[model samples]
Target: MSRIAVVTLVLHFYMAITVSTFANQTGRPNVLVIMVDDLGYGDLASFGAKDMRTPHIDRLMSEGMRFNEFYANCCVCSPTRAALLSGRYPEMVGIPGVVRTQPESNYGYLTPDSVMLPELFQKAGYHTTLIGKWHLGLAKPNRPNQRGFDEFLGFLGDMMDDYWTHLRLGNNYMRRNEEVIDPEGHATDLFTQWSIQSLEKREADGKPFFQYLAYNAPHFPIQPPEDWHERVKAREKNADPARVKNIAFVEHLDDGIGQVLSALDKLGLSENTIVVFTSDNGGKMKYGASNGALRSDKTHVYEGGIKVPTCVRWPGKIRAGQETSFTALTMDILPTLGDLCGVPLETEIEGRSFKPVLLEGKQAAFTEPVFHMWLQNGTKEAMREGDWKLVRDNPGDPFELYNLKNDPFEKVDLANEQPERLERMVRVLMVHMEKAQKIPWKRPEAQANVNH
Candidate 1:
């Protein structure tokens, strides 16, 4: 061929290559968000827990990055989940805590105004499905299906009955969209199966999908499959009976997670998918759950209450065999997924995207301060700003400040020694709370304190 003809061919090939690369980079990826109930930070082997063998979870960490200073936003289920779904503070959604009651009510529940991450995906032409616990709200206008998920099959309550068959009755039963019915097998296994079915359907539909597999395993009234119980019993080999049972239950949950993960691998969706594994909060330490030397347990503002295990895997996008100490919150998941899936969040989100750090394995910065409050009616008990955390028991008690950097366990009280620093942090917390529209705990004396 002549030189002019060869040059023309080379130019055409170069243009095609550029266009293909741009399409690949801008293409929306399928998202698989898996959240475990009451899973402690130190439960997984990748998180430095030598007790349990979490091969599936560890594989996710090995292929992605493990977040060491990640927090769950709330110490409980419903609130944290609300924050996770909306990318906003749970308190803003009026679900300051878990939603509990026989007949669900709209009082203090997540409202329709709050846009969920799944809804964003749905609008972006992605099929959204949730197969697991959705404790954010149970009343009308707050259900998962109403919030943007095309399909939802799970319990609306925080806890479930037995693993076999269906657990609770009359509003407690497993729900698909709005109908209540009994699902066979364990809740964990059922969730896994439903997730696989959704994946298969999405594959056939020729559309990207978002699957939220929230497992309510290893929570309370711990029970496990017979095989898992036998295996854990053999491993313990004469250890405490209760502890053995608890381990068995955890292992059983792990097995269920493994099934779903294996299905993803089998479906050949692993490379084009982004999977994030985390927990709602710390473990129930009373039941022999390890928090990896963190002081205190759930229900407190300490590290154990908020900080939890976190891992993310996005094949080809995120580097494998990476670990990061970059602080992250459960609320960040929505925005991060939004960035990865090309779904721009509509709600004004408090959490920022960590896409830069996840894809490049580089250190990132968080501009917004993370806040926490545990109140019964209208009370603020705990709040954290940056590395400084303040804990208060009642309105009368003095604020206890600690530098999480120096005292992550919150063992030492530095309020007296670092009065100025404490004051500054208190001001930061007060400003945040005010801007967030959080009502202070109702106390006659507290009103006076706030005015002063």
Candidate 2:
């Protein structure tokens, strides 16, 4: 958010266009995407947080390009995950909101026809697996195995009430494939070890792999290992209770990440792997989370709600310590990976690959800026056209506009002054909203249960 950081980001991308891109390069790198739940933009040490240490994740930002203006497709989990995998907005795929375990609270379902990232990689002869958090569906058609992931070894619910129990409302959601078996460790630790084991298997099989290691951590229940919790309290001494728990939980997550990264190095897979770390959305402000100077937190389309810390690390492909202010969405990951791995998608998607930006330093210029709308029961909507953004909190609410370039925190309301810009973004948003009518989000049988 600093003037210098902005300046450096622009210069970095503008000069990158002259460099060669990695999309056309040989040797497809193993893709390992690490997505954490509800991590705020300022949660990482590299993002200028002085209160905690996240050296493992911070190393990723330093080791590769850190996207300063990265935005998650939605302010919540399931939708963003849908967008990230499908390379399209969540609503476009019938996921305008969270995919809860209970039918009544569930807001979205992965469209049966949509092509996902792992499918593209699978077509390219890559072994794909998802080791944590598969909230896209709780049953048959939408399971990870059905959705192109070769294997699924994690919980299949929204958020676990107890990290240890891995349950939601007393139902066991843990699974290793179709079998319901209870895992014996903290969720974060189990996921990390599973990822390490996956890497080891890749080395043994000698196959290119795509592992989506999503972690449900530091989100709620705010559970950290007792040792980690005590250590934070010991070190920070009388820190705010909420801050202490959050810091400890996030730090523990970071340590797990370190273990995963270390596995890559030990397996000699570091150089040949493209590792990306990002969150589903920004942190919850009221929950001892900080989004730095950004406006609001999760569930709203404000910067704090949608903006996230994103970094990509591929040893020889992407240069170290590079940063870009590319206004990219979680949806962009699909097309970007497809192009990078020489695997083109057959299904249509709204995402644009910033491969040129990543490889050659070209700036991501959009004719129509990407969107950030979360209509989970008609709660929030946001659209971006360049630096201009439009947001509204609830259904039938008056829209507010802000020029994010000048006011990163969204402090100024330009809705009255920039009528033309607001109208333009609204028109774009409406067009996308209209398209959502084409898909049925839930089963007809569940219709009676879902009020929204």
Candidate 3:
């Protein structure tokens, strides 16, 4: 009614708008990506494992959304990790197979120009840290610190020969940002501890962080603590010895996960952090791992090898106890995180964001054909578009077609019955292969010579 009152009201409105804008910019959610190595689809209690217990992982799943049709970009380790961080097909980034410490055995070399996920986050004012397996590269220009992460504390090699010893081929690849250090304790426990420490330090700094906590557990050499192994054996009297070891190993890893999640809760970061749990590939069946009813196991182009259990939890944002059958590859995670964090990806990438699926609880319709390849053991490859899948188990082998919607287990082959569909899919696969051929998977000759 008065001039002073009207001006005062306008000033209040302007201040409110400014404060809201500042909050939107500074209140970006923290991201924690927990990736396990060679975990099976049917390995956890929540996913349908009757023999194994994973209360921590199951609880996280119950608090978030589960992706039933999630897949690794490849059937192996390095490639899928490469695809995940770079938001591109592994082959496009010079990683179609494993990256080993041995020069002759290494199959992938991360190109220097590829923009990693952490780099994008760092540009968006987030502190990036990687506290686990750095299988992408062992040396400069590709290592975690060299790429983007502000902190790196983990194993640099592909796999450790012994979890307690933390050595690969008698050489230590464990490092704290380029400095090799031999830390005592099991690898799982050490990683878990380091992750919590990082979170605590970051919390003190009062900045959002993107942490990738990777664990190499339930993998080969199925080593669990004696107590855990004994507990499993005591509980499952009729289970095989190998199965008992695997179950114990997984349960121990689950406990470490619980510790990490508990730390988040105590730190009061759970409400604003986005927690993601997934595996690089499927389980190695011979090592007492199960892929539910999926056909085949790791290293093969089947549901078991490529498909993985994936879930995301963001309190107050993603609804709890939800699941979706949206078929998505691991590469999609980068773009999805970018979308959620309000980061714009300036460079081109093949991964499409699935943000709508996470927030809306709906399957995002994806028509793009997803392709997979592993250039080892005869170059197994596969492609899927919608519900139809085309798989070539080896080089020079006839492609088998399957309607995954009907025969998810790949019990009956529809190759002969659907010749036209098979041919069309093959053509698409050939085009992808042609593009992949242009990218060199091996390190440059000079770089290889230097490493050797």
Indicate which candidate wins on TM-score.
Answer: 3
Residue 190 shift from truth in candidate 1, angstroms: 0.9
Decoy 3 TM-score against native: 0.93
Candidate 3, residue 196: how far the Cα is off, in Å: 0.3
- The regions of model 3 sitting more than 4 angstroms off are 1-25, 446-452
Q: How does candidate 3 score on lDDT?
A: 0.92
lDDT of 1 by residue, 1-452 (tens): 99999999999999988975764677578889999988777777767776577787788888888888888887777778888898988877666766765423222466546788888999999999999898776566778888889999888776776767555543455899899877778787788888888888887776788999998887766777788888878887876776677777777777777888788788877777899999888888887676788866666667787788888998778898888888888888999888877787776878888888898877556755578765454445566666777876445578898888888888899899989987877787777667555532122233476689
Q: After superposition, how far is residue 401 of candidate 2 from its true place, in Å?
A: 0.7
Identify the runs in model 2 with alpha carbons over 4 angstroms from their true place.
1-26, 447-452
lDDT of 2 by residue, 4-69 (tens): 999999988876643324422555778999999999898889998888899999999999899998
Q: Go through the candidates in order and give each one's C-alpha lDDT.
A: 0.77, 0.87, 0.92
- lDDT: worst 10-residue window of model 2: 17-26
Off by over 4 Å in 1: 1-26, 102-107, 169-171, 377-380, 393-396, 434-452
Error in Å for residue 42 of model 3: 0.4
Better of 1 and 3 by TM-score: 3
Weakest 10 consecutive residues, lDDT, candidate 3? Answer: 442-451
lDDT tens readout by residue for model 3, 63-118: 99999989999888999999889999999998988999877788888877799999
> Cα miss at 132, model 3 (Å)?
0.9
